[model samples]
Target: MSHPHSRRVRRGLIALAAVGGCALTTLVAVPASAAMTGSEKAADPASCPVAAEISQGYHDGHDGVDLAAPLGTPIFAAGPGTVTESGPASGYGQWIRIKHSDGAVTEYGHMNERFVNVGDTVTGGQRIASVGNEGQSTGPHLHFEVHRDGGTGFGDDPLAYMSERGVSLPCTP
Candidate 1:
């Protein structure tokens, strides 16, 4: 035979426990959600270097795809990386190479102007250069390439590589 006051007190304690449990769950869930949000930002799709369709696809002896944009169109870094090379080449005229954390390297060639220098760290989508008709290019365009082994090996199909990283560069089938 519990007293009325005792019953009221027990109900109050139960209610308080339920509220405390909810608060605890919310506290635990918030940090997890925050961590995921941070990861999403880090894993954001690599930016397309140029805002133009692929003028040329990977085939035959072509090592990279060309994006035909007006001369001086800004080119961005496809992903976060450190600039390993940024200088004139025999065939590329002006080129920039970035080594990513995954050991892959991205190359941008025929740039009218390069904004970054060797050993410089750049973030994904950072403006690194601009389109140009430098080197052996026929007209103004950006030559983009991806290397699987930090530019030591042959180039890979950049379209497929960018696609795997959730970037859909404008291109025709």
Candidate 2:
């Protein structure tokens, strides 16, 4: 007759294997973009904040804010994240884009020089690029954009987001 102990052992092994499989899946299920170290996720934009106000301007059929600065003005990381894209992007001129762990991305465009390269991890205040007039710009100004999760395909209105941060914009009546 088959032993009851052996049946119990086989059942226990199957249960353990199932749990192990699930753990592996959980680890692998996380996207590479979302998998960030603790320090990277805790970045604050105010620390490496935009030190200048935006010049009134419009781009891509939307009103984008411009950070007016002298050429070669240090551009800091808006948030802790990895540089997924860097270099000239047609209308963007010389630009650097960081993808944060929260899926929010920041774009710094019209740069005179790029301090970081692609795949580089940067914290807030870390210099990523320099401001300049490039692409389709009117003058030396940094075109700043904050994009939401999976919203990197297009630009978002910085006015709305900046307003939420207690930055009031002048009403153009």
The TM-score values for the models, in the order shown, are 0.73, 0.63
Per-residue alpha-carbon lDDT of model 2 for 62-88, expressed as tens digits? 535787877877787765789988998
Off by over 4 Å in 1: 1-45, 171-173
Tens-digit per-residue lDDT, 14-45, candidate 1: 55667777543332222232122435545645
- Supply the global lDDT for candidate 2: 0.65
Predictions in order: lDDT: 0.78, 0.65
Candidate 2 RMSD to the correct structure:
15.9
The TM-score obtained by model 2 is: 0.63
TM-score, candidate 1, is 0.73
Candidate 2 residue pairs that clash: 48-125, 54-66
Worst 10 residues of 2 by lDDT: 164-173
Report the lDDT of model 2 for residue 86. Answer: 93
